[model samples]
Target: MFQRALICTDFTDSMYRLAQFVPSLAGGGFKSLVFFHNVSVESGREIPREDPELLEKPRQRLQALLREVPSNIDVTIDVQMGRASESILRLAKQHQSDVIFLGTPTRTMLEEKLFGSTTARLAEKTGTPLMILRPQLVSTYTTAELELRCNHLFRYLLVPYDGSDGGKTLIKKIHHQVKTNPNSVLERVRLLWVIDENVRRELLGDNPMEQAQQELDKLQSELAALNLVVNTTIVEGSPIEEILKTAEMHDVGAIAACSRSIGGILKWSAPSLTREILRGSWHPVLFFPN
Candidate 1:
């Protein structure tokens, strides 16, 4: 479970959309939320020291805005000067963060061909799970009696498991989260196992999908004992596609995925899947890296 989560920003409108997700993450018992923004300084560029007011003004406004977020959990804000992804990773290490939150904008293939996404880069560099939130869906915000106002934006959660060690690792974290949150508005969490067509064509000569379903059934039974209302889904298609469809169908708050670090034979990486899901789903994504 993530004890301290860092929300990385470039101090844009999209950053605010991502900030809204902190309440739900914190409501799940995360201890602290750190707001991080990076300012770039070129080698020959004029120094902020020459005209400090140019830098000081935005810094002050960011501090004020962060103060307004209603969270009993600890909140800290940091505005730095450096490369964006590098700065975020440094801060995560300095703070010992377990999760990083990012807001990704809808990008065209041409845009991705040129400028890569920051969230994607961070997801590859660290063990911390990076959560990428979509743009806000609700236009209005109503304050509740106590604590932060409910945005009612995301009420569902989708988790994809392949019956692998990595998948179970993610399930354990989610289980801990569920056990901790007794009052979370999250109504349902769906576990999905996709039978990739390519794998079926290669590995299971006759009935690969059936064998896969049997494994998923056992995994579902194990999850049922947790006593939380969990829904199960089994689909046959691309793994990323199936996961995204399930999330969209449920209007999920976010998708929590477990991924492994680069290893010997299994060079499978999740940054692509993370980017793919962010591109397809308007909901947020929570990534767990092994």
Candidate 2:
């Protein structure tokens, strides 16, 4: 339910790729979009202010491309100069953006290790849900495909649940995501309980499916009481794969998850399922800290 969205670009093919999702957003019933282009010097690099036109080139190109977007959705253009991540985050805060869409560059092994991910970094920094698009992924969806994708973007979303206090906290934040954003297209919630067989003998038992179903049913009842359509799924094998398959089957556009902070003996870090899903999911992810 986002009334306003901030879409950031870097004048790359991926940026235009991210733009394609805008029409998808409008189909999901968003009111307005802010298309932002940021010209940033590399982390340790400096900008030559003397050649102001060098900076202006990115903005000019971005504005020219905006004309290609379907005019049905209200759109505005913003040009800024700064660190890409910092500028995008600042604008989101300044505009009170309901959501932020970003483009992630496809990288090789060396690049990934050295460059990491601006999109992932931003997601960690801001609780704001991010839709990260890669050029190839974006091209797979045509106008028709996007229209179909948009239809149920929020209809069925998957949440990997633990049934812990942290899990409850995650759900509360997800409820906020559903309620706070005016243009959120969500209609249903699917609760998934990842059984840690290493920890729970019950999970390793011959008939753990029944137990998983019962757990899902319990959570379903809780969400249904909130007037949301709820779905339940029980899967075995890797937790992340199960979660991703659930999201794929349901055609979920986003995911809401909680991260357990890394600690002493526990050494809890961002959940592996969360990391795997983000790395592989076509959908955006919203992570809540526990």
Candidate 3:
């Protein structure tokens, strides 16, 4: 679905592995790729200075991964000096990237609050969809397996839906992608609805399961019109756990979701399923910012 992508790598995140898969990524329909690294300015450098020599090592380190990139795929290795969030945004805009790949290891909520998350900050600032892969998984994958994964990063999606506005927005975006890009790799989608047992019964009404099924049916038909193979499921439990469970049960490239409340004024206060999914999912998360 994505034509241009900006892939960010910190030396530890295993994002540099993507540099070795340019031909494999081309199999997934990418037209252009920018692999970026931001050399963090020293914490207490009163006099900031540009040292071309300082950046060359990381530049060559990333450059080591590329070999026989397909002629159709334009690849650029960008090493710049700045904070990561600012540098990524600038490079993304410069590249006109539709998708940005980030390697984010799962972190505790308290850790996120204390140290802060660049992914969270970037999500709030950019409209470009972010696909986060866990470094834990990326680092362990064999080269052959990673090469196979490169070709299906956007193939099948396991989407958690609960009829909320945010959920609807995600569905709409998915539809837009399929409609606008005839070459979109999104082929199958599983729409999952989980009923939270914590919610008051009165609010859920008498037939929550049946009601959810009906809504999913309508959504399935809507998506099926675009020639996607769509399926739906309903279960009872914690929304986060069940969604993760469902994702593991099926074959999917990513768990696609969106949220308006994740990063703005309501960020700290909002109890967002989107944020929860992003924090917990080991599967790659395709997040469309609101």
Candidate 4:
């Protein structure tokens, strides 16, 4: 459900390879695409120097890739020298991009703690939605696989909801986008609520299962009004396991979620369900900042 996209990549991430299939991406309803890369300023220099030759290489490479895109679509390459996250946010605003595409590799906990993640940093600074793709998975896709990937990027979404504030925010954002974008690819959504079985059992008379079903039913009606087909299910199990399992069981393009809070670096370091999903999901994740 995105028209304009700003895709950032370090030459190594393989996400830049998307430039080779711009026409396939257009099939997903993206009208404009900007392939961006930021070259970090060299160390030991008081002022960063811009080397035209160094910049020209990537620029030319990107241009050659764009040649494969359909002529009817708008496409460009952006190569700059600066901090990666700052440059990305700046470009997204300049382009008025609807989504920012990023490739994240699997990282050990130690690596994330020490090196920090650019994706995590950008999420804190920008309001644009992020489409996080796993490099290991995407880099291996065949041409036919890539075409299917693009065509269904936003056709359907699997949302993990718990009737919490974060869940409400996620629902509101989806409603807003559906109302605003007539060409949105979001035709269907599946709402899942997983009850944590580890919690202390309560002796209260209230039936938790029935309560959860009622809540989901009410939400389904609200979302259905936007001309979206909404389906929901409630299950008792480990939150992460069930969420991931349900995502694969359904015909969803992405798992939509939001962070519980904006704790900056701490948020990235701490254990989070949303972060866990982002890291573990083989399916693409559409992440919204808290």
Instruction: Give the clash count for each candidate.
Output: 0, 6, 0, 0
lDDT per residue as tens, model 3, 81-166? 87889899998998999999999988767778887888988988889999999999999999999999999888899989999998
Evaluated with TM-score, which candidate comes out highest? 3
For model 4, how does the per-residue alpha-carbon lDDT over 75-172 read when each residue is reduced to its tens digit? 97999988888799999999999899999886666777788788888888888889998888888999788778877888899999987898999998
How high is the lDDT of residue 148 in model 2? 66
Q: Candidate 3 or 4, higher lDDT?
A: 3
lDDT of 1 by residue, 143-255 (tens): 24112422332245688877767677888877665556554344566888887766637664476667767776776666566564577787888888788778778766678
Order the candidates by lDDT, highest first: 3, 4, 2, 1
Model 1 weakest lDDT span, ten residues long = 262-271
The better candidate by lDDT, 2 or 3, is 3
Please provide, for model 2 over 146-217, each residue's C-alpha lDDT reduced to its tens digit, 9 standing for 90 to 100.
Answer: 556545555666788866665777787767776666556678887877776456665466756776677678
The pairs that clash in candidate 1 are none
Between candidates 1 and 3, the lDDT winner: 3
The candidate scoring highest on lDDT is 3
Structure candidate 4, residue pairs in collision: none
Better of 1 and 4 by lDDT: 4
